[model samples]
Target: MTSALAELSEALANVELTVPAAPARFLRLEFLEDAPEEAAAADVWSVTLDVSGLDAVPAAGDTVGLLCPNAADEVAAALDLLGAESRADRPCRLSLLPGTTKKAARVPPHLPEHASLRHLLTHCVDLRAVPKKPLLQALRDDAPLVMVAAGTGLAPLAGFLEERRARGQRAPAWLVFGCRHPELDFLLRDELEAALRDGFLSRLDTVFSRTGDRQRYVQHVLAEEQARLARWLVDEGAVMYVCGDAKGMAVAVLDEVVQTVAKAKEVPVSEAKKLVQQMQKDGQYRLDVWS
Candidate 1:
């Protein structure tokens, strides 16, 4: 007799596949700003885009695809716009996530009109929903939320915090943000400080890597707060969110988390790794990273 796998393969041998629909075109509104947040890093800036005509706006911590011609050193700058929202002026606000460079080129303050930008609106391609790479389902749970971010990684987390504040949801939240210098490189400093003062954020930790005697990244700061972090994870049932460059910062912070958890729980490294894996599987440890 034929095997079950062979029977299933034969049953679908002639099946036809369906193609997914294309994205809807959104109208580009206007450029708001591309001001530099840090004097030390001249190329790093906060960029904004105004958009309209979407069936639905993405929630906080969501991403939107953007195709801007001649914006970068490359042929075109196709970027993922973070912190998307619909504003009151019949326009949607697109806040470019922090630490973005177009082929290492500086972002101009103005967003020039391009052929593709015009065609997008004329063609009516939908960009309402962007695929989610990180799971933020923990926000819905009762567990405390701890956010770790560096450079542009803070953008989406900012949006998430704002949404939570707007909804009057005061779930405990801790933010650990790292930059080159606090005076010259801190992104959204005013907003973050206000959140802390107003009680939206339970804890706020900022790390400046360049000012210290030794170059200390966010992972170093995490190590210093290992006790608090471990307690949050093991006792409080906290959800950890990490966002940043995948090449170094994110990897380092993840290592710190596992090590701290192991020490806190008095377990072997392998067992600690299993705990991390389980957290990831259960959607408690979320990551949104890019190169």
Candidate 2:
């Protein structure tokens, strides 16, 4: 009686298999802008990454992740600890994960198979990365959108706003942005106001936490507009998108929503919270926050 392995080998001993090579991915860092150098900036460092070897460019509101590789000395030190410094530039086998669907996971698709550490770090990896790579999803063209954010949170939302304008969309959009100071860290203040003047946004509100203003944070701004927000959701079929600090800003914004719903519907806080959860599940409210 032959073993299963032996039988399998014997059945196709003469058969040959051929595999095709995978394409390479390229990234070029084109520009970097720091907040300290610019007025109306919010302590943000914006870097632009140019990508190749992909099927399509990242559409509006989709920012690709780039990782800054370790320095040569750091890499050398780590390699010395492993006692494999000589193999630092060695080639490696390239293969896809087994049993994945045709969709083909594309997290780092710009890398070629059989690459070395130096090649990957110095040449392959780009700008940085997103933890857990959350998918905030795209907004519908048919529905109006309400964007609430602070500081760098405006990064992704800016893409959506511009894309809509480029597509000649005249829908009533709103942006409620918050920052530390208006003259110092009010990100994209001029551009935002331009959009407002262009009739792209029906309303644009800004808040400064450090400035002497009645609206300290975005939550305060939300409360002031609770009646209108409720109407937007209940009648105008608007989508709410919140992006920013997970710890502070996110919590405050959410708490305000819960309170708004509770007062407007005359329900208990617990019931209103449940309604907010349902709205999230129903795609009426979306959050993309990072800590």
- Per-residue lDDT tens digits of candidate 1, residues 72-93? 3221222223221221123333
Cα lDDT tens digits for candidate 2, 105-209:
654566777688666655665423345645666677788888899888898888887777888776879899999778787787887888888877779999887
RMSD for each of the candidates:
20.9, 20.8
Candidate 2 has its poorest 10 consecutive residues by lDDT at: 33-42
Best-matching candidate per lDDT: 2
**Clashes per candidate, residues 3 or more apart or on different chains:** 9, 7
Which 10 residues in a row give candidate 1 its minimum summed lDDT?
80-89
Best by TM-score: 2
lDDT of 1 at 87: 19
**Residue 2 deviation, candidate 1, in Å?**
80
In candidate 1, residue 86 scores what lDDT?
25
TM-score, candidate 1, is: 0.63
